[model samples]
Target: MPNNKPVNGQKTPSFFDLIDQTPPPPVLELDSKPGTRRLAKLRAAWKASWEEGGFLYQRWEEVLQARHGSWHEVATWIKAAALFGGLSLIVMMVDAAGDIASATLKGLSAAPATGAGDGGGLWGTVAHPVQVFLADQAAHLAVAPAALYAFWQLAGLLGLIGGFLGNAGPRITWVLFGIGTLATIWSAAPAGGRAAATGLAALMWALASIFALRGLTLRPIVHNHPPQYQFNAALHLHATIPAPTPASDDFGDETDNIHPLQR
Candidate 1:
């Protein structure tokens, strides 16, 4: 330690003053290290996901507690089923639309040839091409049927969404599903495997329709409510009694009746 005495009326250096004079330690650049930045980003993402998941879990817990014995759980499952069914319908619709588009484009590309080398009038030319295009569309039997199927699928998807949001009644969804199931079964080939697969699909559609109807019916009844509590008479009986006041000579027995035991 250096000498602490002041020289020539100079003020003595305190411990804090000495600390202030000390140089700060060099700060290491953690970001300069390989993989440090990537690790930090991953950690931040994980922390955010964890927080979000915890929040969702807490909300789910609250819902379960508030609606413990209600039909809410059944309704939730039905909605989930409807969502999955809608996804399937969407996929089928996309496939059908693709087929229709491809067929239509092929017919149009070949349309000019059908009207070529004709000495007919302008009306004849237009009429001839339209007829040819219709004939071409008729040749691909699958296209028309696919278009119809796609339309029904779209209708069913819309009904499912609308019913889920309470914008449409359950009957509409049920009707669409019923139509889709019938069409699916009707279109099934007589072949063994194909018929079996189509039958399975129709069964699924029927089940979805039933669940959708039930879910919509229960929607109004399956809502959250404040927890109900009943008054506990037994708890009131077990409550602690008040202590008795001490008898005063000046106010003899003035408070004796206030205590239940003394009374």
Candidate 2:
């Protein structure tokens, strides 16, 4: 028999007593049903996705609200417009290049033979290709409306550049862009499936024109009225002035000395 008595105001330790004092291991209760487990996982994923989407929307709203009436906002709009305009210009250039290449190839393929006594001299050799290329281009232009559309795009590109460089007037830029827009729309009739692309190009040109006009008008005003700090002479003089005599009739008046009556 083991002795079970208090030692120094503490109970004597025993194996069974220690076992009873120890905390039990936590029992994990897992759902055996796959449906419930899957539902729980789906619910958790949805909640996380909702929270992330909300956070993103909140940040976007904050960004949109932060820069109103600022130069940064104007710059962003101009940059966006310029980007679209540049893309449109690139597409136009590529289309023009393709057309020119096709016409040149066709002309060269159908060039006259350079046989003996065929008047194919040094000058003829050089001028023959040029003549053929120009003839091909003219024939294609006569049959297709691409010539006018290409001219419009070229003129609009020049006007856009000039406006940005401050070398062109607003009215000229507007006219060029207007002509380009109409040409783009007119040319779209020939582009069966590519009409959407032409419309986008026209929209880009319009956006560029609008923002260019706005920038041209706003830049001078923004540059002219710079922020200025107005110095208040009275505020600086407050510390230097002596305290007023409590008994003086014109105690707080700084100009009392200047007036003979007050003095």
TM-scores, all candidates, are 0.25, 0.23
| Displacement of the residue 58 alpha carbon in candidate 2, Å | 73
**Winner by lDDT:** 1
Per-residue C-alpha lDDT of model 2 across residues 120-173, encoded as one tens digit per residue: 654333223323333445575653323433443345566766666666574486
Which window of ten consecutive residues has the lowest lDDT sum in model 1? 122-131
* Superposition error at 74 for model 1 (Å): 44
Model 2 pairs in collision = none
lDDT of each: 0.51, 0.50
Candidate 1 similarity to native, TM-score = 0.25
The most accurate candidate by TM-score is 1
Report the Cα RMSD per candidate.
Answer: 22.0, 22.2
